[model samples]
Target: MKHARPLPAYMVTRYHGWKATTHAENKGWYRRLADEGQRPRAMIISCCDSRVHVTSIFGADQGEFFIHRNIANLVPPFQPDGSQHGTSAAVEYAVTALKVSHLVVLGHSSCGGVAGCYDMCSGNAPELEETGSFVGRWMDILRPGYDMLPEGDDEARTRALEKVSVTVSLNNLMTFPFVQKAVEEGTLSLHGLWNDIGEGTLEGYDPDVDAFVAI
Candidate 1:
């Protein structure tokens, strides 16, 4: 079966408009960065959710943020195995190479990947067999959190699990040797953020208070 051409006229027109605007807005920054290289102050690890766009949310322009995105905005424990570690690679580059002072793990409400973890933990649904390849492996990172949650109603349990999962991912960030050393040497700091979609509120992790406070 022949597939239809993906790029339609409307998409092409929109892309052109975006390209023009982006170029005009970021022209100076691009020139300066191209000459001197990017030295972004922070690195943001966020989810690959269309609604939770880091640039748009933070009002960041080009070369402003070193971003690393993946499913559920998860940061996996560092491993030495020579495998494809996209998130880890980005972290290493951002911290060691770019020397970003702050690393923020940005989580949001109504996250599909987090919702998937809720489904897996509850056992209401079987292991996804159709697209059971990468998603299954990716969702495994949330298993420890899932197991830790107490049995209860789906809504309450899922909400609790999602919040706890943010903490879990934050803990996992320290497992990386680079991140650990950076934090120990006071070169880099880690922060966790939870964005409420409905309320347009941002809650940031307070290490001193050991809680997420609205910002």
Candidate 2:
């Protein structure tokens, strides 16, 4: 099947608008970034959801953050066994190359990935369990998180698992020897966050309280 050769007109129009406004206005900043290269302070792993606007929500400018988005913002255990791990590659570059001070895993409410995991764990989604299913395999990372939560209604379970996704990712990050060393040496800090898409609110995971506290 042939794919659309060119981008849609609306997308081109939006790009032009952005160029005239955000890009042109910050021409010098963009130029400087080009010349000096990027040295972002934080590496944010967030969902692929279009609703989660990383830069806008943080009021960040160009070159401010190193952001990576995947289905559920997950970081699998560091497996350097000649396997292609996109998330792990980003984490390695951010930590070893960029030497970023913060590594954040941002989960969000109404996460379809979390819901899928819920359905998957509950045996409601057979396709996910299939060997040919990529989403099912990916969401398996969140299985331990789901298993940790107290049983509840579907809505409650999904909501709780969304937060659990963050903590689980945080735990997974530590499995990397470099990440653990950085945290121990005080060069890096790990954070877990849950975004309420509609409410425009954020909650941070508190290890002490073992709950998500409004931030």
Candidate 3:
């Protein structure tokens, strides 16, 4: 704690600004949220990319959605071994503790993690190919999706692969026992979504069509 640096001036100023503006305006709402606790309807799993604003995308306010973000928005297969699992812990909490009605895996265009995976699989990214690279190891979860990538130009393939990452995460989420049981009981629903960041358009996975359709 002693080694950690103080907050940057800009960030501190922004926090004060928000506290005086948005937080002041919504004081009652914030107080109610703190008193009653959050009962978010959905748990949104999104990428850690700064450009991907989960709340802004849905026009949502505080306490509306429980969000978990990570590289590529990937969800690894359930292992349950005595090991630290950030994403799994979040999923468990959202399903068991929160009882969220919907669990959404959100992927987006121009995703660096997905691109890194593609390069790693293609033998092009030496840095990520290293066994010690955490990002490379984490991205191994998306290998199944890489297998399903359709033949196309680089741009098209990358975009299609982005959606594939979402699809893969949705499929992997079902591997968790709690998720499976909740889904089977008709209490929890899983969804996959891909966003075109530049265009501000979202596409949803359609099991019937086996593809991402515009939403």
Candidate 4:
């Protein structure tokens, strides 16, 4: 194997800082966790946006939540064609192997992926519609959500679709047989969440009201 370049100075300094502080403070807790295998109770599907800090928002410690971040936090319908599917694979592992009690589909406001889908479908982003675009194909998972959004100002439409994307993923998660079985048997619960990054507020999808309510 080829030798890789060294890490940046700032990254190395950050590691040393963490080792001296957080890691030092949590050494015993970390050691216990390493001795015992992780048994996380929840699986969080969230966007890959750097602004969305999953652990920070939940105040979660290590081994508390199994998180999978992808573009738009989108999950496609269950497809068992013996092909590569990263999101589905994670869902399968979390449901079947991890036996997580909760599966949360987390979306956030001002999502670039959601906005790209809106633009692609609304004839504003021609480049995204190209056949070879990976992001375009990925954003297709949220197309159904975009179609269901009510017409409004650009900002309103974007925010609405962002929340819709969470619903779409939650709906699609049921298409997976294992997920459906777990949910039916009361072994797993599904949740839809939308975060306002700027406001630092969270809204949860209420099935009865058919809207996101502050939690």
User: How many clashes show up per model?
Assistant: 0, 0, 0, 0
lDDT of 4 by residue, 108-159 (tens): 9899999999999899999999999999999998887877989789889999
Highest lDDT among the candidates is held by which one? 4
Model 1 Cα lDDT, one tens digit per residue, 1-215 = 47766788999999999879976787887789899988899999888888887987889877889988888888788886999988889988998999999999988888888888778656744663236547767877877888777678877667666666677888988998888999999999888898887787899878798777889
Off by over 4 Å in 4: 1-3
Residues 1-215 of candidate 2 have per-residue lDDT tens digits of: 48658888999999999999989999999999999999999999999999999999999987889999999888898788997899999999999999999999999989999899999999899999999999999998999998898877889988999999999899999999999999999999999999999999999999999999999
Q: Between 2 and 4, whose lDDT is larger?
A: 4
List all candidate RMSDs to the true structure.
Answer: 2.7, 1.3, 0.8, 1.1
Q: List the residue pairs that clash in candidate 3.
A: none
**Rank by TM-score (best first):** 3, 2, 4, 1
lDDT of each: 0.83, 0.94, 0.94, 0.95
The lDDT, on a scale of 0 to 1, for candidate 4 is 0.95
Candidate 4 pairs with clashing backbones: none
Show pairs that collide, candidate 2. Answer: none
Say which candidate scores most in TM-score: 3
- Residue-level error in angstroms, candidate 4, position 71: 0.6
